[model samples]
Target: MKILLTAINSKFVHSNLAVRYLKAFTKDMDYDCKIREFSINDREEKILEEIIKESPNVVAFSTYIWNIEMIKRLSNLIKLVDENIEILYGGPEVSYDSQNILRELNGDYIIEGEGEKTYREFVEYKLQERSLEDIRGLYYKKDNNIFFNGKRPLMNMNEVVFPYEEDENLDNKIVYYESSRGCPFNCSYCLSSTIHGVRFLDIERVKKELSYFIKKEVRLVKFVDRTFNCNHKFTMAIWEFLINQDTKTQFHFEISADLLKDAELELLRKAPKDRFQFEVGVQTTNDEVLNRINRFVNFSDIKEKVDELLKLRNIKQHLDLIAGLPGEDYNSFKRSFNDVYSIKPEEIQLGFLKLLRGASIREEAVAYGMKFSPYPPYEILKTKDLSYEELLKLKKVEEMVDKYYNSQKFNNIINYLVKQFDNPFDFYYELGKYFDKKGYFNRNIGNSEYYKVFLDFNMEILKGDKDILNELLRFDYLNFNKKRGIPDFIGRSIKRGEEEEIKNMLRHKYSFKEYYLESFEIDIQTFLKDSIIIKKKDYYLFGYGGDIIHITEEIKEY
Candidate 1:
């Protein structure tokens, strides 16, 4: 029988590892199984036409919260095109509540839980080599009734084959790897909380699998493990293996900052700059909220470990804070935001709470008086402690953070501006309000417009020091973009032959052929072509055309 596996990703760059794993697991089967991937942004008609052209007897969809609505519509359309096409649903979205999903959608069968072994067995049953009743973790319709065999046992990590070797073309895709299968902590909002204890793959096998990406020079490989450092020994083995590899591939991990040990920190310090990145979930600093959500974390300890990591300055840290959780009001969330903001991570992901199906928090949502949108990605609308209006305010603040703080384009200006306020959160909150008031959020604006808008916002508040703000914004602009003429809004400092003087000063400092100054990390040639001289308190030359680096300290009075 012809079989086709489909994945609808949130973005074009995301490659679904689940479909790849399933296809790899059933490779030895005689059935012809092929995989097709599409993004949620793709037209439904285009996907439907492609699936019909495949003309497969069986089509299994990899489902998730982001793509469930589309899958529901696509599944119905596929059946309408051909009544005989047997549709199967799998992945975390359909893995739980198999019977309900089968009732809700036009799916003929549902594969619950881990599907590697179950799918292989299902393929065997389809070929008439085995009985349908014996296949575990499957919900199927026979004659007129639906049946679930039972929950499947967790498969051994080693039994699963590497997912990428079968297909070679992975250009511009973020490779997803899983060095372990489960989590030790019971964070109520997460799906990993439903599964107890961590199951690690063989460390040597993991190293071998990682070697493929290292050799391919994949841009990024994000580990899907929840709390990657739950097991110190297992985690360290992979970390150590990766550290020794002479590769440029960056690895990302979701880790608990509080779990970091002295040895782990020491090892991380030796890692190459930008070789490793960590995403730590600091949901809230309120102990009551933490206890209510079943997330037991000592914020002080987390801050300490994060501080140690910050000192290293090699590994990039992405700190996350969920805005809506039990007992966390807007004020409490502001505190949470400020607390994480103080740490100064490379990224502060200000996310809202989502009540995922099968997660412990979804069940406890009612008791906590939580209301969320009844749809895929069940985002929190209101909690007992937080109003819908307050949540919307936080949403505005989130937008401001994404544009200014996380973009790294306005680093110097943001660092300077936030100091003028009581706390960082208030500055972002006020900026967010300003954006909403000026009708800027609805318009599609360019980078120059953003600088102008930010300047206008600051002019309203910081009545004193307009020139300094203008120069700071100008410096921030030159730091990021090529030497586009300084915008009219951001006044220029260097004028009337100062450019030649600066060039002559640079020539006097370095050899004729030497273009790079190591201390400032600036190339004299590019600096001359794509840079501007601005003065805040002292004359400063800002370079562009590469990464955004601050040369504030390296500036000397000219």
Candidate 2:
């Protein structure tokens, strides 16, 4: 049988690890199996054309909340093109409601839970044209009736095959791997809570698989483990192995900050800069709200550990906050935002709660007066404690935070401007409101235009010094931008004559070759053309001469 496994990713940079696992596990089977990937952004007609060219007898799709709707449309289209082609659905999106989904969509089968073993067996039955009644974890339609083969028991982690093989090319793509399955905590809003216990792959097997990635020098490998640090020894072994390797591949993990102990901190401190990124889910600071969602977290402990991690100055910390929870009102969520923002991690993700399928929170949503969209992603519209209008307002705040804080382009200006408000949340909220009033949300704002818009907003609201703000804004602009021309709002301080005189003085102090090689690491002509100087308390020099920026200061009289 000709088999085609398809994955429609949310973005081009993402890979579907589930499909890869299915392919690897069924590698030894006697069938022609191939993989095809497309992003959700791809046109429906274009995707339909490509799948038709493949001409496979069976097409299996790996579904997720972000792409399930697209998959549904494509599946029906594929059937229209050739009704003989079989449609199969798998992954978290269809796993929970398998039988109903098979009946609703134009799919012949659905694989629930862990798919590797079950998929292999199902394929064997199909290749032999035998009974699929014995295949567990499979939902199939026969004689116009949908039949589920019952739930499959979890398989040993060691039995799973490595997703990435030697022949695959992973350049410019994020490789997703899981060292373990199931989460230790029962956060009711998350799908991970549906599973009971944690299961880990053998440590040696994990090391061997990771070694392959390191040898290939993959740019990024993201661990999908819900709480990576739940088992201290297992986590440390992988970290230590990566730290000792002589490769530049970066690893990302989602870990719980409150679970960090001294030993873990000591090991993380040794991690190389830019080598690791952490996602810590501090959903809310209110202990009562956490309890309502069956999430047990100590805000104080999380803050303390986060501070220690910040002190390490190596790993990039991305903290998260969920807005619409059972007991969190609009005002209460603002407090939670302020509490998390005060920690000042590298990034803050302001997310609304998602009422996902199979999560306990979805079942309890109506009890708390939670109203969510009845579709894929099922984002919360409001709860008993929050109104739809209030949630919409927070959406604006989320936009501003993403543009200013998370982008890190307006770092200097944001750091200075946020202090002027009562708290960080107020700062972002006011900025968002200003942007909305100016109708900036409707227009396409360019990268350079952000500085001007922010400047106007600051002056209008804070009535602060334009000169000081200009200097900081210019400093931020020069650090990120390479173009020599400054925005009209951020006019240069020094006259052309003084700037030339300073460049001449530098030439006399050090030869152009030596200075460019040691400091800027670019041609002297490019350095002279691109570099800009802003007069703060001192002459702060900034240049984006290479892949990295080098900022220097000249205190001497020019």
CA RMSD of each candidate after superposition: 4.3, 4.6
Summing lDDT over every window of 10 consecutive residues in candidate 1, give the lowest-scoring window: 515-524
- For residues 104-217, write the lDDT of model 2, one tens digit per residue: 998899999899988998889879854799899999999999998789999888888998879798999999999999999999999898898999999989999999988888
lDDT for each residue of candidate 1 in 1-558, tens digit (9 for 90 to 100): 988999999999999999999989988889989999999999999999999999999999999999999999999999899989999889999877779788888879999978899999989988999899999999998777899999999988889978887348877999999989998889889898888888888998899889999888899999999889989898788888889999999999999999999999999988999999999988898888888888777788889999999999999999999988988899999998999998989999989999988988888888878999989899999988899999999999999999888888887667767777999998998899999888889997888998887678877866646655665676667767656565678656656475455556666653423221222222323333444333333344433324433333434545
User: How much is 354 displaced in model 2, in angstroms?
Assistant: 1.0
Top candidate on TM-score is 2
Where does model 1 exceed 4 Å of error? 461-464, 508-558
TM-score for candidate 2, please give it: 0.94
Q: Using Cα atoms with residue i matched to residue i, what is each candidate's TM-score against the true structure?
A: 0.93, 0.94
